[model samples]
Target: MSAASLPGVRLWTGRVLEDLRAGRSCLCLLPRTPAGGADAAAVLDELLHELGDFVLLPAPGPADAAAPRGAGLPGPPAAAAPPPGGPWTDTAPVLDYDDGLSAFGVGPRGGGPVPSDAASAAGRDTPAAHGPAGGGEPGPSAAGRAPERGRPTAHDLADRVLKELGAAAPGADSGPAAGVDGLLHRLTDGSGAASRVVVVRGWHEPVPAAAAELLRRLAAAVKAAGLPPERRPRLLVLAGPSGLAAELPEQVARDDVAVHWWWGVHGRLDTATVVAMARPPAAGRAARHQLLEAVAQATVVEVCGPFLDLAERLAAEWDGSPDTLPPQLRRLLCDEGLLPGVPDPDDAARTVPAPRGPAPGAALPAPAGALREHWDRGLADRWDGRLRHWPGAAARRDPRTQETGAPVWDWEWEHGVRTRIWLAQNTALLPLLDEAREAFTEVIRSRSRLPLPDLAARYGPRRDGVPGPRPGTAAAPGSAAALAGMELGDMWRAHIQGDARLSQPEADRLRTLWRSRNSLSHREALDSPRLEGLADHLTR
Candidate 1:
């Protein structure tokens, strides 16, 4: 797929374009990860081609014999050409502007060759001699010439930049000498119709002291210059890793030089976009949505390149089935911790079942009645008051459309508040609620004059003031003997408040706990202050 179509690439490129158009220079840092390196490079190439109309002057490599040419600077050769029968070919055209126009006013704005006298005065060869028609070769004149191969110096960079702008060779026209000042003069001279984009590759390498100083000066000069936004030149430095920004001179920072980082988490692609890219043409919308959600949950970390690679692999083998995920995709999700791994049949059979009630001799009884039913049939069936393999509740039903058709899972809501509440209950609030229940039970047992069994029998779930058995009688299902079966909500409403010893403020404190308990049971969470207050009250 084209890099421009990738969400991360599009976002970064759009921001850079905005900076350039606003006359701000940029320093683009490529991803340090090996997998992302190729993706960053592809995006850079795409951006360069996309800005074809701009004066794109790639800084010359150290080995070039002649000065850099306009729209034809060869920074480096491709590592290898695509194979003839490969799935893709490398036939994309290079960025080449019309050569008839000179960088200065030697030719008409429409189009014409540079005047012979003007070309010679500037020490420039005819446009044809500078490079081939398509910006491919150095032409016959430069073919046999060889230059020292090492990092280009600050002077070398400045000279080429000035020449590309059609400024006379440094010191030729009594202009500023070939250096940062001279280059700035030409760029801010207000001569060219198009903005200049000077893209310097291989910036991850140690920059020469002179080159670094030159860059600082150019950045400062561009900012200080009051040229219109469209007329200001932009400098884009491309590097492989990060931390290089610190090495740059402080002037670059002071001027607010835009730094675009494409690495690590910063480079992650949108999950939906990646899924779309990897989806088979024949896949149904439901299949696409499912895959998108699975990927979003699976990729909790920033690893866009590897994730995209896996998605492509899945696409190649996908059968376009909508009912279930492809086997390979399922295994991938399992490995990513999104789905549960395959369980051994013997282990599954031997696995202990979840506890259905409080342990024997506990301070309080397990919940009964509506609260018990809710715990078993509601919370347990959904999230079990804990986030397990999926870390999310089942897809929620949309109330608005439930009457018209079979309920459909609202994936959006599932990913939103539902997931958040589930996380809070499992991680922060549920443990405190459990503690509050035990504390409330102890307080009641210690403070009240009435026996716990009699209190429960009088106030706990039963029919219309009709007592089953006296406190000392044999315990029946609905008798006071079942005090242990009442949960915090039932005990608070049915028993705790019935005790006259509980002061109004104390009763109110217990009420707070009851409300919080209900909120959690209904899939909501108390705010931090309430939770903290609840904990403090329990400790007291």
Candidate 2:
């Protein structure tokens, strides 16, 4: 795919579009297609979406237009729109010049501008989409404005974006999915300090200028709201559609966007990761946000893979993403949402404790594949996983160490970017954790029961915002007394565990303690010690 000059790519755009027709603001990835010659903007538009409701991307530079189009690549559609009041229309696939406007020849319904030229003369080889968040020109796209940036901008197109997402908007840093609303509200009202993000992943270039314009607005809004660069919202424009590599970095970047999980395909929400994703804080523990920005902006040069690993440590957070995430980290951060209150960027660096230095082979790519052998431990870690991208097999890594006697733990995907299990604890145990995750997913999916308020049924009038043993008390201590021993033991053990994922020594120690505390075992049923030992030996 990379070998092609103007490589047109296809990627799952996700189902966020449902939020659009429902009247909610959203961000989406519009398909990108290059046109022949250096005409830059859209000379002709393509009718997309079965209902003809979709948008288009900009034309590629002339050099790229010479590349081979996909075999059987559908030709462009007629310049057109849907029935006057009808929903979008189309059954056949369509490709056209992304001029950056709506089928209505306007900005998305009720928004301003993000700074895109109607002709989509937007800069960058790639452009992002703002959905309805870009408040300018109501979706006329770059023809009238810029793609909506997460923050406010000073440029003409970006100006429309600033008018919307100011300080007064409801600010959502992170939390419930509803937080997205707060972010949108804050973008439109307040100083725009609240961070939000829009992500675009596709290999096709000539990104619709509307996407860039939207980015400008977001940037402008951030400034209007006094958002320091560290807390600014982000719009991550990916290179292609199909591969999952973009998801991990997009999710874990120092500047992260919220992830919306939806049900897809037979019994498998977990079955597919629309975009490989996870998350991280905007600033590292030390609060060196500048360093983070440098990495995010792709400005740093890693001297070696370890240097990049060292950077991840020095920053106190992994704002700039590394290529490979140990499997053990698949869900390690389900609870650590970025806190709402912004911390002083400088203070983060000052207060952050020193790091433990880079992990061994930290800069090295995973055990197998040409990337491992061909990769140069040059002055900096280029993390080919980030710099180079492909589709399908190449993009979705199938790493396996080719070394004659490599340990199973050292096995690598033969086709994708490679990396060692960055974290020592993940060594030789990712498969087990993956299995557990799969099983746990199956268990929950087996039933369609509502997942919340299992105790709601026992609720009554609250003396204070809690349920009481008697009347008028929210969560009375007395009502919870029967479970006291269990609580105490759980607290004690959890405190000791400290999320190390436990080892045989720790389990053995626990077992000795359990045996010595027979009374504790009979009363508290401390059978966990043995189970812990079993788990450690079997998996770790």
Candidate 3:
């Protein structure tokens, strides 16, 4: 499919064009796209191929990459991984000027007036939907500058760029030629044709302290320089969450610099649109609906390839039949077989027989081909078939059996809960830990004999202003706890108490621990050793 057709690409293109038209610098905050989905690199490639009159710059290494870390916000953590290079290099510059915006010219720093009326007239006449044309040939060679001498700093690049634009003499040090200020002055001075833009790629990686400082200086210069509207070259900063607002001193300061965030597929692209693109036309409405929901719930990385593969298999297996598959692939793997229904303490229904598979019409296609890779990763971590599952995957596996199909229904509630908690330890923050616990609670809820709605009500939120009952207090008829107000802590305790595998003392500790979750705040640093101990207690 053409890049322009994808929803993600369209959203990206719109933003870039908006920035160019306004003659303002852009600071586009990029998110990591799933493995098979649209990404910033793809968008940039499309722009280079079609858009004219822009210069692309590589990231100044980690040293020059830093921006202000927001107050009390976490420092730039490491990026998950570096992006792979394809047809384009993040450092290369692509210049094209088919649009009127390209007619911008720059005067020298401290130079007076728009250089010429011709440049201004051309910019005013440029059309917004200027069709794709090759970036016109470089006058002074945009490529091959500062190569053998090593990549230049932002300051040096800005200086070199001005020299290329003919705004300054080759060795001129107008006001010491310090930063991007010189380049900005030239672009605004009317020395070039139309307003120019410099796209700074690869800010997706963590920004180091020095680079942060360089950006601060540049921002200050931009603010103070007072370049006219026509000469102001847009500087687009493309980065991930950590790198998002790092160019600014605080979150509020982000307003002055355009900050666009990527909120995964749900926000950046339409769910129905993504589904339509991934599945065949014959795929049923129900399958498409399920795929949309699954994509939302799936742990996003990039547009996940495994997910697309699974969707294809599901559609092919159904083949226009009326068979309805389970909406979620992850849920299907863990909940459908081995474990059966969750054992309810007050009721005699403990181990319901596992159906040979999912209920007849709702069965999911087997995890084969692309699906198996994710499934295998979801299963044994050690891969020796000893059933070593990650925290997220552990909750779904049958705690009672070995990987080779040996029966060992000696699974204890504490052990299962402990494995889930193990997953929690890997997370960097508290809210995520709470999410992992909630997933475990939901897994058990799905297997209960009680209707899904009733279980949900019993476990739903407490009424506004109604305080939680003291941990051990008896429920009053009209009190919040009595009106189906049992929180996750309560539901978890009840489940733990009914399992004989956990002694009363262990159960009490576990319940107390569950309630303790409320004490942790989102911003609070996790005490790993302390949480790990709780996991140990569960196993013991």
Judged by TM-score, which candidate is best?
A: 1
TM-score of 3: 0.38
Tens-digit lDDT track for model 1 on 131-180? 34684433211111111122233545666667776767654443354444
- Estimated TM-score for each candidate: 0.40, 0.20, 0.38
Cα deviation of 501 in candidate 3 (Å)?
59
Q: Evaluate model 1: give its lDDT.
A: 0.44
Please, what are the lDDT tens digits per residue for candidate 2 over residues 1-540? 021111111111222323222222223321122111111111111112321322222223563466454321222223212233221111111112223232222332224343445333322112222224655333322222232322112122232233333322111222111122233334444343333333332233322232333433343344445644444455433321211222332322222122221101011111011111222444433434433333332211221122222222223333334332222122122122211122233532223232232232121112122222111111111222332211111112113753221224323321121222122113222343334333322222222132212222222223465533334334533233211222222222432544223345644544443342332323322122332332443343
Give the Cα lDDT of each candidate. Answer: 0.44, 0.27, 0.37
Better of 1 and 3 by lDDT: 1
Full ranking by TM-score: 1, 3, 2
Residue 521 lDDT (model 2): 28
Kindly report which residue stretches of model 2 are placed more than 4 angstroms away from their true locations once superposed.
1-15, 23-55, 58-203, 206-211, 214-540
The window of 10 residues in a row where model 2 has the poorest summed lDDT is 262-271
Could you give candidate 3's per-residue lDDT for residues 143-246 as a string of tens digits? 11211112223444554445444455422332323234445445544556335565655443233222333344434444565655555555555554343223
